[model samples]
Target chain A: MATYLLLSTLTDEGRKTLKARPERLQEVNKEIEAMGGRVVSQYAVLGLYDFVNVVEAPSNEVIARISVELGSRGTVQITTLPAMSVETFVNAIKGGR
Target chain B: MGFYVVLTKLNSDGVRAIHANPDLVSAVAADIQAMDGKVLEQWAVLGKYDFCALVEAPNDAAIHRMAVEQESRGRARFTVLPAMDMALYVRLMGQSTETTGPHPWQIRWPVQIARRALRNYWIDQHVRAACQPLTVLGRENLDGLARPAIFIANHSSHLDSLVLHSVLPAAHRRFLTFGSAADRFYIKGRKGMTKQGWWNSLAMATFPIRRGAGRATLAHAEWLIDKRWNVAIFPEGTRSTTGKMSTFKAGVAILALAKGVPVVPVFLEGLREIRPKGTRDVAPGPVTALIGAPIRFAPATSVSDATYAMYQAMEALRLRLRAQRRPDGPEEAT
Candidate 1:
């Protein structure tokens, strides 16, 4: 699975939803896992963004679907970034055919 | 959560995202909170930047973490600046007791003005007169452009603001406050900001405005306006990548309508070709400054109408300039 970093913020309705049901966040995380993505880490941040998520998925199409699915829920706007660990990056760049 | 400013520029992917779903922007903000930041305020602005968001983070590490997440993606670019309230800013300003003022940048008044004048003269000599041949039309229209007027122009290149400032009469030029992008022009940190602030104040006659219409952005411009200084703003917010005009933001309209100042629509041509973004070549060209007749909206006119008329006026000015070129002379029957 490829790693993806998701930077997100809750919408007005999303904020209301979170305030009304704090458990909803965990439930949504479970839903994301069900969609074939695993949430490796998550952080609630302060500044132009609200949430940062590190996730793993099988492919670009899977992540695109995930971003669109979650974003379409009208609760959170998501910016998904592809990411890799430094070790993996170095190994790739080393290039042994 | 501590306050922070997020400056963002949308790439082609970002543009497509928004085109497909405008609500995606709000969702992205929610993503920030999910990342551990609280987006306190956000604005979509015209200019080089797409959005400027003020957020609150628990600490530097949290924001840095967010930065890493955002920057790793090619969808958009972000410049994060830590923010302090005015009270905290003043308190920090007071940390410097050596000067009569809170900051050294504010202490010097006369010398800064002299340096600015000299710099403008240099800009005139090297850039305006010698290197670049800048033409002027309807100088008579500027006759009525009084002090405290708002000069609204379309941004096409780095030279646009300077060209507008240079063409202004000295009486107005000395008092003109240019709106400059804070992230691009100045550095962070107290000492760095102070030094850069002073330099910008002198060189550009600029007041740094974050890329969007945050609460502080227009307020700062209004403060400058109230001080009887002429203010120049690029309604498009950023320079045009392809040398075409972009939509004018309502900020200029609101500022003019709220302050009851006459808006002088200044159309600049050939600036983009002369100095495109990311290009070091300052190619010589005939830069035309078409100063439209000053527009003053009625007290009851809405901001949208005023802004629309301003844009139309600018477009018309450009068209009129284009039509004026003939073998006899470049004189247009205005």
Candidate 2:
């Protein structure tokens, strides 16, 4: 499986939703797992993003699909980035893959 | 019961201790349970925070006490936020917000008689039961105090008003009126009264006070003062969640100044642990009501000055009581 980084920010409506139902944050993680993605790490942060999530998924398409499904709720906007290990990047450069 | 989100961050020492013995992490839940709180869900997540716990506690004071005890060991820092279910939050928002009050009939002779009977038999018993071994200090301050005085106290719990009423000298209790939150207690109706509002006014001699309504809201209070009714108000306006005195609102000052009445400052101790705001259950505990000497301003005292003076009076009482409670010295580990 490939690793991906997900950064999320909540809209005003999303804040209301979260304020009323904080458990929804964990529920969304369950949703991700149901879609064939495993949440490796998640943190409620205090900076530019409301949450920082690291997920392992089968492929880019799967992660993209999960992001789209969650963003459609209008409460949260998600940005996803595919991540590669430093060892793999160094190997690819050496082998000229 | 109140739901709380307790976000705990372990310090370096805490991290080392937990790393040495991971089972120590369960101590968080145990600490909460020790405080009569239930931990519903907790996660040791990887992030800026070490752990997040959803707990149910009787009130803010209980949860705060638990947090203080836990953090005093210098292992964890906690941030607690009160939570409500989504449905309950929406329903509370949908409640009527219009200010409708100052029911005139509440002061009628018949209604006053009924209020006295209710206070004597029902309300008094409940307060006495919940506030066992209640102590009233400096009540002689009210012995010969004039009628139409304003009794101002530091607000810490929902029990403040009830405790104030229960311990008051009978002479001052009669013809006493208090201000209740308009949005919380009253609903706008065609006749300016709802069932709950009617009962509150008749049973407690309460008139609605619209928050931030300014001098206009004090019209009814002024009328009460003219009728020689004593007014009891928590100048803090709202109950303190942290057992600290919030800034005193100027309403009490305004009323006392306009009516040319003295303001008696009463300091309430130990009520926050009994049944603070947002708690349904009452735990019987000892409570002390320390009444300060009446604060009478010279003629034409400015509103700001009057408010500050009144606040200082209550603050003095609080400090004096705290010093008395711990005669040696204040505890270093808060």
Reference-based lDDT, each prediction? 0.71, 0.78
Residue lDDT tens for model 1, B1-334: 3567676788999777666656667776777889877776565543455665667776678988887887677778987766644322323333432221112242147755665657745466546542256788877888856779999887867777878877778888777777776655543433663355556666666766665646556776787788787889988877665455766778888888989999998888777777876566787777788888889899999988998999999989988877876666443322
Each candidate's iRMS in angstroms? 15.2, 11.5
Highest lDDT scorer? 2
Give the interface RMSD of candidate 1: 15.2
Report model 1's TM-score to 2 decimal places: 0.51
Where does model 2 exceed 4 Å of error? A1-97, B1-92, B120-122, B188-195, B326-334
Docking class of 2: incorrect
Model 2 C-alpha lDDT per residue in residues B61-137, reported as the tens digit of each score:
88889899899999889877666543334334455556556898888899988887787564788788888789889
Q: Which stretches of candidate 1 lie over 4 Å from their true place?
A: A1-97, B1-112, B120-122, B129-131, B189-195, B326-334
Per-model DockQ against the true two-chain complex: 0.03, 0.04
